[model samples]
Target: MSEPMSRRTLLGATAGTAVAAATGFVPAPATAAGNRVPAVVRELDAKIEEAMAAYMVPGVAYGLRYRGRDYVRGFGVTSLDDPQPVDADTVFRVASTTKPFTGTAVMRLVERGRLDLDRTVRSYLPGFRTADPAASARVTVRQALNHSAGWLGDYFLDTGNDDGALARYVDEMSRVPQLNPPGKYFAYNNAAISVAGRLIEVVTGVTYERAVRELLTGPLGLRHSAFSLEELPGVRWAVPHVPNEAQTEIVPQPAAWAMPRAINPAGGLISSARDQLRWARFHLGDGRVPGSDRRLLSRRSMHLMQSNPGPGGTLFVELDGVGVTWLLRPTAEGPKVVQHGGDWAGQHSGFLMVPARDFALTVLTNSDTGPTLLDDLFVGDWALSRFAGVHNLPAVPRALPAGELAAYQGVYTGEQIYFDGSTLTTQFEVVPDAGQLSVRIDGTEVARLAFYRRDYVVFPNPDGTVGNQRANFVRDRDGEVTWFRLGGRLYRRGAEATVQRRSSAPATLPRPILS
Candidate 1:
């Protein structure tokens, strides 16, 4: 393990700032008096700066619309190696947030009577088959959209940059094992969505990117969005950055700039904050193109995309169910929110909207640790309450008896797959504590897992903030604790110690890597 880094080192590594002028997208009469930026937004700017310093994030571009006004700003340098101020037009990879675009394209086809949501996958792709042929035949387009296909979802096979990328990727799903019967449970399945993209390609007779452009992006006027690096020339884009091995200073990601082409439909769109806000605005408004009356989706279809189709639950407590492609959650003040976020190797992006209130927010950052900062600001009462008049209450941690906590003590093992088709063996050790369960990953204790309710656990951040992702312990048929579901992935609770003991060399403690 690398040595620890000092506070000064972390701050110095990320202290570079480049503030640009704020631009509003909403238009009023030229003679109308302009309103000053909200005081909350000014305060949010300082919060972003301080949090960026604390989390070692190099750059951020955010756009927000609330109460019929718009606020857009960028902060910090684009990259440490080559510094450039990020502006409203600066592009950042929005990753899995691209899922919604794919969803929108599928909806467009449905609106045109070209596709059916309830149709089985075999109806569209006759050759589509998973390891469980019986289950494969039952998977529907809606199941894939809602992530209930139940097959192993993290398959990220690189099929090269070609029109057949998604087709090749879906063919490989034949070997993926089904985790549950179709529509039984919810797992965050990237592989399932890739199949949905392939369906779009089959129905539209075009590449996934081209079809999305024709159905959504082109019609929506998102000129700053692109799916590949070659399309980014002459345009400013944020460089991905990550913490060094020492977890001290921020550095650029040493790997490839983007994911495999096959995963493009899952998460491959590079977009600017301005474009993201525009995208959210379209979702918040009626189903028409911004300035034109061209209706991409009917009102019923638009609302259907945001409505829950079946029983589904997410790892995050804030989210209750899944829409067509969006995560559905309710706020404390009685407003429902449809939102999605994305995570690339070193970049993080978020988009959220409360359709009832016409409030939308988009945040793009070029740092792996950006989510820590975003969880504090986005879900915290500051942004949601000040602008949307609603807030999400995180699960409150509660103390439990030692006997109750002891039942969960054990080492659980799992595998995490990345967009490059790489896998990492993961181990989690849960030990008994006075009031909570001491949760350790590998050998390092990272969180104090306490029950918020019955089997639901909440791990608050080190800074005493809530809104951190919550997880749960699963029970087997015999009523014995058997699985640990964290971040929507399952970890079985045995055989890990045997594998470690069988190794020839001494076990070295590696950093805990989570999806």
Candidate 2:
């Protein structure tokens, strides 16, 4: 184990900051014949400092690459006690960023003709089942890959580290009812991925660990990275500083390895900035690794993993192209940018790709609250845009016109809507929508909602809509609709549902809260 570091020694190491406007990307031996560009590294350094103070961050280690050159920096302590400074090579638990690796491994099987994307899970695992036994056998590999499997978020509370925890969890999931048909809605989930991981092991004829080693790192020469937390000889490590709100006494959990029992493929990988650079570049090459004709996956398959399938097509964060892999968001500089963020026990990280510029930005941290690093990254990116003379694009700005509010009104219900009004007490019930109700509380239009069209169309403002937007409604013993739903959060469905109308009327209200 590495000795814990102190804040004094950590801050003392970087001791001085460069006041220069910008610095060249740190030149590396590997770039002898590669393309490289100068970066505003000095500005990046100052911006990170500002974000740390802003996000109440404990410590951060980040890498930024523009053109082909790389720049790495760290701030605060890797460990609060005897604080240790973070550096480019310092390892941090990358959490969900590991998903792409799993995605890649699965795609490799596709290339080998070992697995069929549209085939049913029972075709391979044969153990698949659902609360609705008839529908359970119908889940396809694609549904599992995209998280369209109507499985409720993992029964995380009963989850614990043990030999057969995963098996037990899968059994529990087999009997749970679906919120809707597969491919019917999007619920960013984790349990399904762990099941996918085990499925990969069963099909690949190799342990999950060894399969990734041969498929990725070994071929790509990623020396300092691995799915496990075991440190390389002579390599120093940084553990995660987790936030624990449950304790009577506040405590920060230090993690050398992610909780691997239930969330492995979903969230469990430890890596360093140096090694991560290779991972980002792999995707940058259009998912090609070095020289082998992109072995294990066709270019078509690679793009499929990152491209949204248009309208009615599935898009859950867990379903890559949406989550932490990379989704293109248009920018003023003539191209759509792709990016993703990852969070673990005590760490946060983000990866953004600009194919037009062939650029990638990566940041990693050793503290749970490292989420603050994003503010700095965006600020630095904005400053970069200004320096390059490119204007930044304005946000999409959701919702109908202030005046057209009436046109966009009337209770609209769908399996996926994020409407959580003010009150914090609520739950999902049979009301307007049979499965999930997407009640948009647009008071600008006399508090009404309309039938939602697709996933995430509920871009209603943060009057409360920020994170998970679960709706709440009430259901009678016969499973009949009563009112709209938003759990732990309440919203009165206009006047009719608020005041019962012979008990046969629709009730839908918008709010954001867990149900």
Candidate 3:
């Protein structure tokens, strides 16, 4: 819960937009908090409201489920051209949160032993490739979800300007050398997730999109859910936004980025608060997604899907943390939390679960920059402290072992960098002049690169570290820290680094990125 602000005050903050918080994963069942919100939650609510105003979100949809009963609320209009009040019935894209459903779909076959995690990508998808034999041989479905497939984030590389171009970009990446070995270090790849979805289709004899709804959402009884614009619910959806350098929101024109048909599994699933609440209830252990005892699968499989599959370091976690998608960040209350957020056009949405407290929150916004505005609400010391209530966590995780992080200190380029080492990458962009600072990384760039945090002075540090950052290096017997840190992943430096590193240190390090 967060501090409360007057609805009038919030309205004036944006042209009219607001943010809501996304709690942690593994939520417990939520019940009424008596009549009043504890002082802590009230304070958090206010902070969230402030964050929304800062981001210029026009509308927000939020829900809190505690004990058994739940509370769902909405603010502002659902649409801009045709303004309508958003409510529990309004739908928003689940985005990457769709990974959990995708994961479940794959596991359905896994439980039946019809599919294997160790199988290579070509085993199922056959010709899936980018003309790079090395990448084609090494990439696998496990690597897709793990973000270890060596594919860099596509947001920077190509705009997918057209269907032909999007296909070429996917193929072009196939030819690029992988950043790390499959299942080694985590480097998120939305394309990889989509490919994984294709794997489900190959094995199940059903389209990946339909299989997920039929296997997971359908059993859960989620009525208002779909993957495409044509099959979607009514116009009760939030608009997505893009913020300017000043954090002022702007409506982005529909482009290759706005459409869904390209990468549906990676980040595309429109759903409602009422429906998502039930989805959150599953993780909260209410079990039986309001239907049969199919168990859908097993708790073991679900937990495995949720666990962190990183390269045993904080750096890897930064690339792709716990949970199949989004993140399973820990709370001050020691709660194993799971969360995900989305932004498309004027729509912004986020969802979270606090299992220990038996509570969960889902928020959707109608703003180009709403997801980011909504995300900032869940961050910061005071903001996080208030939402988790008292400090229940055993202790906070240090930035990571300096020595280990040093090994991870190269440039990392991938399909996307959601929040690489606190360095903002995807979904949040600060365009400078005619162009934005968006980067495209090959397999190697994922390590050396760091997102430049804006400062009046020392802007865009030529070095990988943002700000005057410090690093530590861990080496193997070869006294080589590269293999041990970057997990033996080879990142080819572009013209910029090709010259820079020559004047600094030797290009090659003996240790590879993985164990």
Candidate 3, residues 256-335, lDDT tens digits: the string is 12544446666667778778777887766633554456577677776766675644222211122534543565544455
Q: Please, what is the TM-score per model?
A: 0.88, 0.66, 0.67
* Candidate 2 regions with alpha-carbon error over 4 angstroms: 1-39, 154-168, 231-234, 242-252, 255-258, 286-288, 291-296, 308-334, 375-515
Best candidate, TM-score-wise?
A: 1
TM-score ranking of the models: 1, 3, 2
lDDT of 2 at 365: 69
Error of 2 at 68 (Å): 2.5
Candidate 3: C-alpha lDDT: 0.49
Candidate 1: stretches off by over 4 Å: 1-34, 417-423, 463-467, 476-482, 495-498, 501-515
Summarize candidate 2's per-residue lDDT along 373-403 as a digit string, tens digits: 5533532245336333333333222344334
| Whole-model lDDT, model 2 | 0.49
* Whole-model lDDT values for every prediction: 0.73, 0.49, 0.49
Residue-level lDDT of model 1, residues 85-194, one tens digit each, is: 78888899898899999899999999888889999989999999998999999999999998888787777777787788889888877778787789876677888888
Give me the overall lDDT of model 1.
Answer: 0.73
